[model samples]
Target: MIYAIGAVVGLIGGIKVYNKFSSGDPDTSKTAASWFGACIFLIVAATILRSFFL
Candidate 1:
């Protein structure tokens, strides 16, 4: 349940980050990739931590 919640949050955050960074006519692909990667990392970390500790 906690992991699910964390994943949802991460997905929402990732979408927001992607939108925020992917705007305008610039080279935002890298920025969006990094943000999405960070979001995935957060989700995985949260799931692992919750499963092991809580």
Candidate 2:
């Protein structure tokens, strides 16, 4: 379930980054980094919660 959510978020982020890249946006790298961080944070948080609760 958590992974499924992560996949969705990844797909959305990928599309957003691609758009930014195609448009030659100056902050594209920053956007990508933030999105990547969000995905990683989600995974890590889920893992920590599962380990603590289950």
Candidate 3:
């Protein structure tokens, strides 16, 4: 369900952050930022929908 999607977003964010701080291109920071945003959106949307549905 939505929780699964949200978890995926979180994992993506973690990978992005790790990449940005570890061995990724410095110019790819924006990609990491986008992942952070996606994680926020997924968590918020999931929370709202979960609240509504259950």
Best by TM-score: 2
lDDT of 2: 0.94
**Model 1 lDDT tens row, 1-54:** 655765676777667666766676365677667756866777778778878987
Clash pairs (backbone) in predicted model 2: none
- Model 1 vs. true fold: TM: 0.52
The Cα error of candidate 1 at residue 27, in Å, is 2.1
TM-score of each: 0.52, 0.94, 0.58
**Best-fitting candidate, scored by lDDT:** 2
**What would the TM-score be for candidate 3 when compared with the true structure?**
0.58
Tell me model 1's lDDT, rounded to 2 decimals: 0.69
Which scores better on TM-score, 1 or 2?
Answer: 2
**Runs in model 3 lying further than 4 Å from the true structure:** 16-24
**Candidate with better TM-score, 1 vs 3:** 3
The TM-score-based order of candidates, best leading, equals: 2, 3, 1
Q: How would you encode candidate 2's per-residue C-alpha lDDT over 1-54 as one tens digit per residue? A: 887898899999999999999999999999999999989988998999999999
In candidate 2, residue 19 scores what lDDT?
99
Candidate 3: tens digits of C-alpha lDDT, residues 13-42: 787678777875675777777887887887
- In model 2, the Cα lDDT at residue 33 comes to 97
